[model samples]
Target: MNTWRARLLPPALAIVFAAVLCSVVLLVSGANPLATLAEMIAQVARGTTAVDIVNTAGAYYLVAIAAAIGFQMNLLNIGIEGQYKLAACVASIVGGAISLPFGLHAVVIVVVGAVVGAAWSGIAALLKVYRGVSEVISTIMLNMLAIGVVAYLVPTFGELRGNTQGTKIIPDSGQVPGIPFGGAGTMFGLVLLAAAVGVGYAVLIDRTRYGFELRASGLSSTAATAGGVNSKRMVMSAMLISGAVAGLAGLPEILGRDHTFTLNFPTGYGFAGLAIALLGRNHPIGVAFGALLWSFLDKSSLTLDNIGVPKEIVTILQGAIVLSVVVAYELVRRRELAAEQRRVGRALGTAAAPAAAGTGGERA
Candidate 1:
């Protein structure tokens, strides 16, 4: 019961806190908060909207996992957005340029994406490891550099399709089909890929020695080093792993839907993923919930304009939720620590009681 409470209470409180705050905002804006919320909830009853939510959540899940990986090693990989875009561009070009067996073609695209993402991230990792440069700064700069690189490479390797210039369209053999979801739109088959990545992330964090070192390094680099863990190696490995996964963030859209990378490709997922990662406290299951909630707000908010309420209210709500979750989690952590201390104190007192009684008896 205590464990369940510990796990559930913070997010529950956070959600309620955010809701209340948003409600106040709605009232101040002269909108019926209850009605606006009701309309948003009603939108989910539509099959198409539900499918969109799940599809969006799947992509958000992958992005959050990528952010969580670097976070686990205390490295802020702000370059996930750039890493994924560049990877998608290169992977799409290669995927379109190749001819292979069905499964092999898709595999090649995925591998190319991972490798390019890792290579891009490796630059920041090397700088941090050798030159004592902060990853935060390097990654921010790299993001701008990636934008320029992609702009230059796109036209060089790609042709203009209509008005949009992009890489060649991938062959059918390189694409994965979406799963039909009744009357609703087809769901991305690669949502399963999100599930697989989540499982792999959980396993890596909970079962592997490298995961242990990563966590230890994040907690305290000096302590991890003293325990015979190489801090530099862990940082590089974590960043590479993060970038590799970040590379895949765009694959679902490319392989399942777009079949190519374009200038108009979706953006903002990297930053949103960072927020979701924080809201989820870096846990796989937690991140899944965060992604779903975030997606729900994003998708449902579109209906708000119909009800005379601004859709950007959802943005304020999301910001509130993130802030509330962080504060709630910290408070819960302190409470848990105090409770633990009390339990230990009581146990030590109970054990000392018998020893004290025996000593007194002997003296008597």
Candidate 2:
């Protein structure tokens, strides 16, 4: 099999399997699966829907990349949720409190976000390295701590106008500009930032020495150490990079749309990012497609109630896709590994047979 085909086939088959399973589910629930699919297709065709999909995908792409960084190093930085929320809160407060020129203001806000996220994530990295703490536990605890911190600080320092509770509004100079996509449709300007991040991620992971070390460490820490790779440093770097990218997860909404961290500021992108990263197999391009597909399904679900189809059907489909794809990928990987071992064994046996025959003839 061609390498590319081998890589893609499992995911394609997984998607088909998931679709069929979802259709059966809908049929059992007495809904027209075909009609529901058609509605989803139609929703994607609308210009306004395109904007929403792109905007959501932009944020999701960042989160997925953040998760992918940790994944590449065999580290699970579940603290992305807390890292991003805390970053957004601090960034918003800083952006609103000070004034700077247009370009500088946006730069400062982004820097603040990345710094805050890295700082928060560093705690987990330190604990893992020094205290032998599991990142999963520490990050989860950090998330709760972040939520409590945000809850207290927002009401204390955040501005309040009637019922709307949020940080101070960012000035126009500090806000990111949007690109108009036909009338009544505007794509977030930070979509370009997300694309840039993707490109950088691809280059760093596929083209850099550091990336090679990171991947080596992920495959086996002991092996990597034997090859002169510092597994501890790699873990720390991966955690920090993951957190920094995670910080940007909320900036698309904050700078390009809402312009403030508020009670209504979106959550759950961190968890969604983890799923997208898994679905994409941690590849940059794959993650981009995963993010877009996930966002499209989420946005399309809004109209399901109008069509008398349950919105939860989309959730079922999404979950099924993730589960099926993961299982399929694992099975395919094992099959590939077995085949490679067989091929190597045959080659060795052939070589040994020729050498043994020569030696036997000499003895004769």
Candidate 3:
């Protein structure tokens, strides 16, 4: 049941249910659901400018991977949206501040961006370690702070200034070029995200002894402490890693997609990332694929409706997909726990039976 394939099946089935429900919605709305779906298919075939979708989806992927890493440690980073906002602002300001060579400027900007995002999240980590605040609540509150502070900084000081908006478009030197043919830089964004995920898997799950300790601590923090693992350090490290990934999402906007920080750019990327993490079973590769599927549906929505499908139909289906995954994960988790308990009980019972029989034989 812990296998990726095993966990994936339930979500896949749920998606099928969602698709059927969407069809039902189309029928009830007096639309030719099949035709509507076909038109949507055609639009996807025609309108998908690879670079744009890939870039936007890359943002979603980075955030999803970040949350998924936290999830692996049994930590929930619900504040990635805030983390990204602050990080993007920091990156833009840093990029604009320096007049360095192109390579150094981009590197410095990205590093500062990642640092700021990590530092912002470190606040929540500090609270969890010292004040015993739940990361969920603390991060959520921190998100509010991030949104306000960045929102202020972008308009007031970031490059998008003068017109009461965010920073001006990032300089051409700071911007990463698109794939040779152009359109949007989404594919390039996706490539960077892939690299990030690979590095993340290596750093978080394999390369370091910390990965082993973190896994042990995540499964049972108290037991891991008894075993001499520094669970506190692992917690902070996990949070910092989550923040760094969130910051990388800014690359899509700052250097790839938008080329500048905006006051209220759509934050659906971060929100969708959370869902993708859950649907992906918190694994890096799984989350990437989950992000891809999520991005596809997102890109397809408007086109689908124009094909006669009602908005309510896709909306309900999408919502159901999340709900179904949540429910199924819970169910699967419960079953696994129950099975483990039963196995333990049987082992204990067998050991006790042997002891009792030996004692009785000796007494007789």
Candidate 4:
């Protein structure tokens, strides 16, 4: 019961708090909060909307897992935005330029994405380990740099074919096949990839030696160092792993839909991934739920304009959830710590009672 409470309570409270806050915001904005919320909820019954939610949740899941990896080692890898973009762009170019057997082609593109992402993220990791530079600063700068690089390369490498200008169009052979649902639409094939990644993440973190060292380092660097865990190695490994996953975050859209990377590809996934990671408490299962909830809000909010409610209300609600999760988790942690201390104190007192009585009897 306690374990379940610890696992579920923070998220539950956070969602409730976010709901109340959003209701107030809606009222202040002269919108009917309940009606607006009901409309969003009702959209889930539509097959197309359901497909969009699943597809989006899959992408968000991958990103959140990426963020969770670095988070596990206490490395703030804010550059996933850049990592995924650069990787997807490069992968698209490579994928489109080459022709190969069907399965081999997709595998090659995915590998290229992972490699490019790791290489980009390694820059920050190397700086942090060797120069004592903060990854937060390095990653933020890298994001801006990535944007310039992409802008320069896209127009240079990409030819304007028809109205759309992007890298060479990936041939059908390189595209990931989608799973069709009659009225819902086809789901991204990479959604399965996201599931596989989540399972792998859980196994690696809970069952592997590397995961132990990573967790140890996050909890206390000095203690980890004393225990013979190389802090530098763990940091580098964690960041690289995180980047590799982030690289794949864009592949769903690229392979399943766009079949190429455009200059105006989606952005902000990196920061959203961070928020989802926190909301999920860094657990793979928890993150999956968080991603689904996020995707639902995002996809459903599209019709808010029709209902005379600002879609930005969803954004405000998401922000509220993140804030609430942070504050609630901290409070819960403090409460648990206090309870633990009291239990230990009582145990010590009980253990000492017999000894004290024996000593007094002997003295008498």
- For every model in order, what is the number of clashing pairs? 0, 0, 8, 0
- Worst ten in a row by lDDT for model 4: 156-165
Candidate 1 residue lDDT tens string, 43-146: 99876999899889988998899999999998899999999899999999999999998988999998999999999999999999999999999999999999
TM-scores vs. true structure, each candidate: 0.95, 0.96, 0.86, 0.98
Candidate of highest lDDT: 4
lDDT of each: 0.91, 0.90, 0.76, 0.93
Better of 1 and 2 by TM-score: 2
lDDT of 3 by residue, 147-231 (tens): 8898778767754355547766667677765554433323553357556665767576767778888777888999999999888
lDDT of 3 at 307: 58
Q: For this target, which candidate reaches the highest TM-score against the unseen true structure?
A: 4
In TM-score terms, candidate 4 sits at 0.98
The C-alpha local distance difference test score for the whole of candidate 2 amounts to 0.90
lDDT of 2 by residue, 179-270 (tens): 98786488998889999999999999999999999999999999999999988899899999999999988998899988989977888999
Clashing pairs in 2: none
Model 2 superposed RMSD (Cα):
1.4
- Candidate 4, residue 223: lDDT: 100
Better of 1 and 4 by TM-score: 4
